[model samples]
Target: MRPFKKIAGIAMSLALTAAMILPAGVRAEDTATDAPKIVISVGDEQKTPEFKADETKDLEISLKNQGIADAVKVRIAPVIEDANTWPFVVEDMNYERTVETITAGNEVMVKWEGLAVRPEVESKYYKLPFKITYEDGEGKQFQLDRYVFVKAVAADKPEEKPEEPKPEENGEPEGGEAGFSNSDPVVSGGGGGSESGKDAVPRVIVTGFNTDPGAVNAGSDFKLIIHLKNTSTKTAVSNMLFDLQAPSSGTEAAAEAPAFLPSSGSSSIYLDYIPAGGTQDISIALNARADLVQKPYSIAMTMKYEDSNATQYESSSSLAIPVKQAARFEFSELEIAPEAVAVGEEANITCSLYNTGRIKLYNVKAKFQGDGIEGKDVFVGNVDSGATGSIDGIVTATQEMAPDQKCKMIVSYEDESGKASTVEKEFSLTITPEQAPMDMSQMVDMPAEKGFPVLPVVIGAVVVVAAIVILIIVLKRRKKKKESVEEEDLLDEVDRFTEDE
Candidate 1:
């Protein structure tokens, strides 16, 4: 019985030793009460990688159970290394294993979907460390640490492009683009302000003008007419005035001044509101002086006016007129008397001088010049512009003059313009002699000289002479008859007596 008890105790001891000498991995939990039986790892063992400014990526953690039993109630917490000091943002965080019950020979994956890595933190790299806690079926907790590493990579900075230049105006390059230094006057000449180039202010133009009477005698009244226009993009205004002056050598006289009217005449016409592209007309009158010259004179017309903003503008024009001499003198016919007067006897002759030039002829002189005779001088007084004066004078023939004599008469006078001139005319006269008379009886006895035929006188003379003759004959016959009768009585006693006898 004692021998059989020893063999049973040894066998029990050997069995006890075998149980105490089990494998270290299977006995690890019993040897250390706080040691974890499982360890967790990530796909990447280095620092977490950086993401681009607009990029997104996913992160994953993998776990395996290498122990003798299963792992239960596993929890994982992800921590950012230096995240509070960096400018990175974690947009999302997700876990694939919610309540993982990992078996000893199995593996699990913890996936983070749509997990964003913050773009370019203050530092170049970023790190994410993970800690996992789990419990075995014995109710003891185990902890594991894992990490990830990343680098910034300064994501490829893109290349920049340059800008292009603009073209210049006037077909020329601007600034240094022309590749030449600009120092010439033609290239740089310009006036400052709004008139710099093609942009400039416009001007008003005067298109037309006119005047009247044109021609006038000295001292006569006349009128002056004017025309004005506004040829511009703006309105125009002006005042009209005229000046009349005589020639240098003539009278120093001017026309009478003119009166002012509202929109016409010498007065200032406020053409203040002439619209763009419109026109207006103006006219005036003036009287010339009496003493003006007998030649041409000048008239200068001018216009002055103000703009809408009270700016003044002016323009001018000149014209000429002729002055003529006034008429004052007239004439009659030349006369001479006693055409047959003897040369020794004063051959009487007479002629008249008439004033014909303007203005009275003061101290007028007249004389005759010829071969056979000497002339006497005649004088007259003022004759006025339209008035007439005359001179009656005689001229005698010389003692040596023959039957007929001729002479030239010259007249001189002064005009109103202080000028003098001469005019000439002609005259003639004749010379002859005289005789005496005698008695009545002889004149009566002589036969009368024959003259131009007088019909009644001749007829009467013939009749008287015939009657006398007849009477004489009758007397004679009667006497003779008486004698014969007496004789006849003797002879009648003889003849009538002859016949009777």
Candidate 2:
């Protein structure tokens, strides 16, 4: 009994470890409309390509540019931080591959010469984060983090499930078994744990899961339906109880509060029976914590059930569900410099953009539209949550606008899922008509307009005449002085002659 307890503890530990290491598919955030979006695909249904252990496999990764611009100077590298998390290692410890460019509406296939999986690697879905850095056609630098899902399977993992005996020989009618059809793939003992040695113990696992609304937002209640299956073909199981929780590392923040909690105050779910190769579904209401970060969280299920012999067995499985924070924002009142303008003139428009929600606004832009004005798109770039951005643009008047005209300022943005959202704000703009040019012939015959500098010209002439009169009087006085000096000299000469006689 103690050995059985030890085995169950080992199984639970492995499940939690795998949950912490595995990655949910991807958030698939949208790039700017003019930028390139590169994604890797290897033609797997789950986006997970299978690799065998202890093999140096050659991988061909299809990198597709999903935007209108070309991705230039593209560099891709695999980020491996832990040996326990990643089953594959880089070749020659060089993790990077460079590409010249990938044009729009096309794809480039890159080959990895050697990607060696560890000899002791377990069978599971392993997503390795690939860092891609590139520039858009307009020379804007961008960095993207994409995960490549690599499904690592131990050499002895496959083909054993299909080789089991058919369940129809156990008195179950044919075609009536569609309730738990064998066609749907089930996970009995492939990842994290295996029941291969315990052939008598029936293994049950979670096949698939989905939420009601499909989009689960943080700080909201949602219904989660988990599809489970009994993989044992010959044994009928009954008296089952399942316990669910979101596995967290022993960090201070995680230990303080769980990311997800049960809405009904209990995480235990009970079920009666699932016949051989049968399936069951368990639905529960859950509330995502308000403070949970925007990411995919893993949920671990500890399933305890019984076999036909009343022998109780315990197994664990996990699945990751993505939760998103709602994107919210608001605009301040539009401020238009010179609210009124004439045709062919320009007006500057601006507004304050605030991110009011927890989600970041990607590629934020504002555009102005009206009958008489031509405005370019105002790019505000990415606005983090609780941050502010500015929307500014100069719009030129193209033609005369109608009276009491109302113009629209449209703001556009995208969420992580590539969903576009727009907001329209209306403001009044006054545009006067363009004036006609005056003809030169009409100006020639036209008299000067009223008050056309008549007083200024009269004062100018009076000052000029006064200066000329003063100059004439000064010249006459200088001539009289010269004659008086000559008369004095003649008198002096006559006096000298009288003295000599």
Each model's RMSD to truth, in Å? Answer: 84.9, 32.5
TM-score for each predicted model, relative to the true structure: 0.28, 0.47
Candidate 2 error regions (>4 Å): 1-197, 247-255, 435-501
lDDT (CA) per prediction? 0.47, 0.67
lDDT tens digits, residues 1-501, model 1? Answer: 474456445555654544453343234334434333454334422223445543556555566665566878877777655565333465545432454698876777776666554555432333455667677676556655543434333345685673552221112223222111111111112223222342122123334334356655445555545444555455443332323222233332422321111122233333435444556655555555555434444443444444444445445444444445564455566654445433222333344445444345555667767665554575655654445445544444444444456666787876655577777776665533321112122232333334554434544554564465557557768988998888857854555444643
* Residue 211 miss distance in model 2 (angstroms): 0.9
State the displacement of the C-alpha of residue 77, model 1, in Å, after optimal TM-score superposition: 99
Task: Kindly give the stretch of ten consecutive residues in candidate 2 with the minimal lDDT sum.
Answer: 23-32
Native-to-model Cα distance after best TM-score fit, residue 500 in candidate 1, in Å: 62
Candidate with maximal lDDT: 2
